[model samples]
Target: MERIAIAVFITGASGLIAQVVLLRELLTIFQGNELSVGIILSNWLILEAVGSYIGGKGVEKIRKRVEFFYSFSLFFSLSLVAGIYAVRLGRLLLKSLPGEGVGIGGMLLLSFLV
Candidate 1:
C-alpha cells in the first residue's frame, strides 16, 4: 500500500497546487470584494469535502488489481481533469454575468462534481 499512498499523495498535492494558484489569482483580481470572494472560496471547500466523501466510498466499490496504485492514479487524473475543465468553463460563464450568481452556479456544479 505504500505505492498507493505515494501516488495519491502526489496527485492530491498537484491538485492542491492548481486549485491554490487559480484561487489566488482570483483573489488578486477581486481584492476589494469580501463577500463575493467568500462565496467563491466556500464553494471550493465545500465541494472538495463532498468530492472526498463521495470519492472515498466510490473508490472502495471499484475493485482493482491487488496493486491498487493504478486506481489511485486514474482517480487522481480524472478528478484533476474535471476540476480544471469546470473551472475554465465556469470562468467564462461567470465573466459575462451581472453579479455573484454565476459564481454560485459554479459552486453548485462543483458540489455535484464532488
Candidate 2:
C-alpha cells in the first residue's frame, strides 16, 4: 500500500541519516582513525541485525499492529537522538581529553555500548 511504502522510505532515510551522524560523532570520539570506521560500521550492522531479529520474533504477539508500528517508529527516532547525545557524553564519562585517541579496546567497548 502507499502508506506502507512511504513509511518504509521514511524509515530508511532516517536510519541512514542517523548512521552517518553517529559515525561522525564516533569518529571524533575515536580520534578519526581509519580503523574506527570498520569497527563502528561492523558493530552498527551487528546490532541492527540483532534488533531486527528480536523485533521480528516479537511482532506477531502484538494485537494492535498499526499502532505498535507507529509507536516503535517514534521510539526509534527518539532513540537516535539519545544515542548521539550518549556518544558525546561518553568522552567525559571515559575521562578522555578532547582529540585524544581511544585505544582499540576502549573503542570497541564504547562503540558496542553506544
Query: How many clashes in each candidate?
Result: 0, 0
| 88 Cα displacement, candidate 1 (Å) | 5.6
Q: In candidate 1, what are the lDDT values of residues 6-84, reduced to their tens digit?
A: 8668877987786675566454433426754676677778777987898788776766644576665677678766665
Model 2 agreement with the true structure over 44-84: per-residue lDDT tens digits: 78998999999889988999988887998999889998999
lDDT of each: 0.60, 0.87
lDDT score for residue 21 of model 1 = 59
Model 2: pairs clashing at backbone N, Cα or C within 3 Å: none
Q: Pick the candidate with the highest TM-score.
A: 2
Pairs that collide in candidate 1 are none
> Per-residue error at 79 for model 2, in Å?
0.7
